[model samples]
Target: MEENLSGQLADAVAQGADEADLARARAGDEAAFTRLVEPLRRELHAHCYRMLGSAHDADDALQDALLRAWRGLARFEGRSAVRTWLYTVATRTSLDIVEARGRRALPADLGPSSDRAVLDGNAPLTDVAWLAPYPDAGLAGDPAGPDARYEQREAVELAFVAALQHLPGNQRAALLLFEVLGFSAAEIATMMATSTTSVNSALARARKIVAHRVPPRTQQRTLRRIGDARVREIATRFATSLERGDADALVALLTEDVTWSMPPLPNWYRGIEAVTDFAVQVPMTRCPSWRHRVTSANGQPTVAFYLGDDAAGPHAAWSITVLTLRGEHIAEITSFLGPDGFAPFGLPASLP
Candidate 1:
């Protein structure tokens, strides 16, 4: 009887061992994958988000990377470890989505801008499309120990993203791969299935184009050193004035030459007076009880405003407000709130 019992106990242990191997094989070991991915997820998401420029697309791309990781686990062969493989999958997928013309998207909040808008009689704006903004809060680099990421921060601002739209796709990919992702030209060539010479040439051309587009943020160097509280106070005041429908007060806070725009909308009002005019005419006239929740969005200082309150919660985080401050005054306001934006901003679709 004792011998028989011991045999049964041994059989049970063997079964448990078999199950463990099977679980590992399935890539169904959630705890292990979590540990593998946790460290790099946020940064990876940022890369994908910048590449795609939509939070929803970034989320999807991340999910796709995860699934691909699961499927390709056996082939991982420990050559590059999990992280690099994930990055490789991520970049290829982002490039594929971009190159395939399959996953291109723009914020639903912003509409088209007028070609004839006067900017010092600037011959109608040539860049008509709306590019989404990124919040500075999500930047992967350290904010302290200061070489000052002035250029880098400006590079991710709402305005720069708009400039990136003008580049051809491959140049865009190459520039992002080299500059933002910190990948080698040879590595990019491997990823793109091209020659090093080809990648280098593309990088040079991309640099030239982006150089012309990136206006030196002559202000950012001094701007970054300012205390955070002082800046937040100014932003808060502007938010309060905006919520009160007091355009005069809002205008008082804005620079005389401030540029105001809403994505997916054709009208772009430049100068404090013009912006004030539009502010008085729209929004305040119709939407009442609009509430702004301060949150980091699109690598900038942003507020997610909800237009109306439903019984359960706020419905559809309407607009992500990106404020560009030059000293104490706001210079550029870009509100990107297009259709289907709630998901990207991590907001609920409908209030209960």
Candidate 2:
């Protein structure tokens, strides 16, 4: 009972401090505003990424939202907590970007899977807004609230984010605010400037689409079940197989129904045979040499590859291959190719 009382007292004190900061921020104290916002920044940025499906877009949206919040600070009535207000601003900003830029796509979303390696003219589709992987460093595990459905990390999984791209801006915003962030329908209606009925309808439609696309079991659950050591072993062996051009060793790591895709390439291979054909033809035989550093992306085991022909020369950044596991086998290989993926993971452009 005493501990409960003490916690309540601490909350009251923090609220008082925040009230003062709010007043100062409203009065144009930039430092006060920074203090008020710093605590909630990471989660808000994640929310933006979920809404927009790209870390780069999330960065721009969060920056624009914070700018809007700062400029409009004087108008904040203090009815809601600062976090709620900021989320409202961020959600609207992301929605605007979504409408303007449209949704991002993966190679699997483009068309049918190829039965064999796409050897010739397989150029990156520069025009398409591809779904970039989120760097999970320092990402939180807690849900936004008690009512939130998705834990923070689970929500950013590549499959979840990719599924979100199929949703319209309003449905995406409504679903994320309600399910992922734990806001009430009425609250989401206010944040999105829509009716509660509309929010409910959007949630229904979004849930249907997402349920169809995303696997029932989340990657977080799979990783937890598989354990860290085993997961690391699988990722390392998968990378080693590529580095040594060992097709049989690589095949042993994958599921019979495994898929391989390189985004912006507009071609994907499904089933072990098709994936093997691509692997054997391209990375194993055609590519000269590979060096890899194991990493994680979208809450899955990932390998960052560096490619170079010369044994003594620097290996240039190639792709960050994220592995989605089913039980003990590798089920999906999403290699987000190119250097743009490296900077977010703090990986170097090239390795010697």
Candidate 3:
């Protein structure tokens, strides 16, 4: 009972602080506005990434949303918490972007997988808006909400975010707000400026679609089961195998149904045979040398690859390869090619 009372006291204190900040913000104190929003920015950015598949797009959407909130501060009637108000602004801003740009896609979504290694100089699909990886560093420990269905990191999983791209803007917003963020139906209805019935319908449709696409088990669960040391060993072995051009070593780590995709390259290979063919023929053979740094993306193990022609020469950034594992074996390898993905992860442009 004492613990419960102490918790209630903390909440009351926080609420009072927020009220003071809100009043100052409303009176055109920019510093107060910054103070009010700074705490929520990271989670808000993650929310934007879920809404829009690309972290770059999320950056823009969040900036625009914050600007909108700052301009409309006078209209914010203290009826709801500041976080909810910011989310409402962010969600609506993201919906507008979704409408204008449409959804991002992975190479697998474009066409059927190639049965053999694509030897031809397959050019990157510059025209397509491809899905980008999220840098999930410092995000794993933060709590979403007690009522949230998906954990904070689970919501940003590549498969989950990619599935969200398949949803319509309204349905996507409703689902993220209700399921991932744990906003109530009535609250979502208000945020979305729609009826509760409409929000319910959207949520139902969104859930059905997401359920079909997303895997039954989340990467977080898999990582926990595998343990941190083992997971690191797997990532290291995979990266080392690639760097050493050890095809046999690489093949040993993969599941029979493993998939290999390089986006914005249109061709993707599925199954061990096809993936092995592609790996041996391309990165292991044609590409001269490779250097890698293990990283994390979308709550999955990742490797940042750098390629160089001369073995001793500086290797330039190549792809951010995100590995999706099923048990001890890797089930999917999504290598998001090009240097654009490196900066977000704070990866160096080249390796000496």
Q: What is residue 41's positional error in candidate 1, in angstroms?
A: 1.7
Which runs in model 2 stand beyond 4 Å of their true positions? 141-143
Question: How much lDDT does candidate 3 score?
Answer: 0.92
Error of 2 at 53 (Å): 1.1
lDDT of 2: 0.92
The sequence of per-residue lDDT tens digits that candidate 3 reaches over residues 198-266 is 999999999999999999999999999999889888999999898898999999999999999999999
Per-model TM-score, in order, reads: 0.73, 0.97, 0.97
Q: Per-residue CA lDDT of candidate 1, range 114-148, in tens?
A: 33333343232324434555555456542221222
Q: For residue 42, give model 2's deviation from the true position in Å.
A: 0.6
Flag regions of model 1 displaced more than 4 Å: 1-34, 77-81, 102-130, 133-155, 218-223, 308-316, 338-352
RMSD of candidate 2 to true structure, Å: 1.2
What is the per-residue lDDT of model 2 for residues 1-352, given as tens digits with 9 covering 90 to 100?
A: 9999999999999999999999999888999999999888888888999988888998999999999999999889988889889999999999999999999999888999999999997888999999988888737633477688987778989999999999999999998988888999999999988899999999999999999999999999999998999999999999999989899999999999999999879889999999999999999999998999999888899999999986678899999999999998999999999988899999999998
Q: Which stretches of candidate 3 lie over 4 Å from their true place?
A: 1-6, 138-142
- List, in order, the clash count of every candidate structure: 21, 0, 0
Model 3 sits at a Cα RMSD from the real structure of: 1.3
Cα lDDT of all candidates, in order?
0.63, 0.92, 0.92
